[model samples]
Target: DVKVTQSSRYLVKRTGEKVFLECVQDMDHENMFWYRQDPGLGLRLIYFSYDVKMKEKGDIPEGYSVSREKKERFSLILESASTNQTSMYLCASSLYGFNQPQHFGDGTRLSIL
Candidate 1:
């Protein structure tokens, strides 16, 4: 079975602080994604990587960046955290193919004060 693991299920940080979120997949998938979920706004893609050492910016990438130095691990970096960035961050991994289903992590609920 495929599994996606997040480093933390809850996180708290202050404004202007740097934050790092980590995710790992066990299925050796070729695609990984980071998304932020908010009520009403739904899930907004933050970034995605098709292969190791490659990344693409998603819908909301203004204050965020990603690193995929290893195929099993993906990291999300918040350059400068702010109150507006507080939300549920989710990580997903999928096989490289058309219409492939993504396996998601439990998510990290981030709070910025």
Candidate 2:
């Protein structure tokens, strides 16, 4: 089975601090995504990489960036953590395309103080 692993299950950060969340997939999938899940907003994409060294901004990319230097790993960087950015961050992977169901890691719940 395909598997995605997130670096953290929970995180605590102070406002204005930089935060890094890592994700790794073992399936050699061509697509990886970072999304923040909130109470009523559901899952909002933050960034996605289709291939090594390639990335695309998703619905909510402000204050966030991503790195995809390797095929199996993707990293999400929060330039400055904020209270509003405190949410459950999820990492997902797929073979490619909307037709494929994305397999998600458990998730990282981040709290900003």
Candidate 3:
């Protein structure tokens, strides 16, 4: 079974602070993704990586960045967090193919004060 774990389930941060959200997958999937969930916007992809050190920008990548130095680990970086950036962030991993089922972490609810 694949297990995706986020570093924190809930986090609090102040505006302008740099934040790092970590995710790890035990299944050794080749593709990992970062997304944010909001009420009206639904789930928007922030970034994705297909291999170590290779990243691609997703739908919403303006204020976010990603790092995947290792196959099993992916990190989401918020350069300068703002109140509008507060949301439920999710981490997911899948096999290297189309239509693959992705395993997702529980999510981290981030609040920016």
Candidate 4:
């Protein structure tokens, strides 16, 4: 089974602090994604990496950046945490395209004060 692990299950940050969320997958999948899930907004993509050192901006990428130096790992960096950025961040992995359903980690609920 494809497994994705998130660095934190919950996080609390100040309004302007920089935050990093890490994700690791054991499936050796070529595609990984970072998304923020909100109550009524569903899952909105933040960033995605198809290969090592390559990344694509998703629907919402403002104030956020990503790194993929290794195939099995991806990281989401929030340059400055804000109250609006306080949401459930989810990390997912897939074989490649939209055909395969993404396997998601437990998710990290971040709260900005």
TM-scores of all candidate predictions against the true structure: 0.98, 0.97, 0.98, 0.97
TM-score of 3: 0.98
Clashes of 1: 0
Which pairs clash in model 3? none
Candidate 1 runs further than 4 Å off: none
For model 1, the local distance difference test gives: 0.98
Worst 10 residues of 2 by lDDT: 94-103
Off by over 4 Å in 4: none
lDDT of 3 by residue, 1-113 (tens): 89999999999999999999999999989999999999998889999999999999999999898999999999999999999999999999999998999899999999999
Q: What's the distance in Å from true for residue 32, model 4? A: 0.3
| Candidate 2 Cα lDDT to native | 0.96
lDDT of 1 by residue, 6-101 (tens): 999999999999999999999999999999999999999999999999999999999999999999999999999999999999999999986999
Q: Model 2 over residues 1-113: C-alpha lDDT tens digits?
A: 98899999999999999999999999999999999999988999999999999999999999999999999999999999989999999999999777999999999999999
Best by lDDT: 1
Flag the better candidate by TM-score, 1 or 2: 1
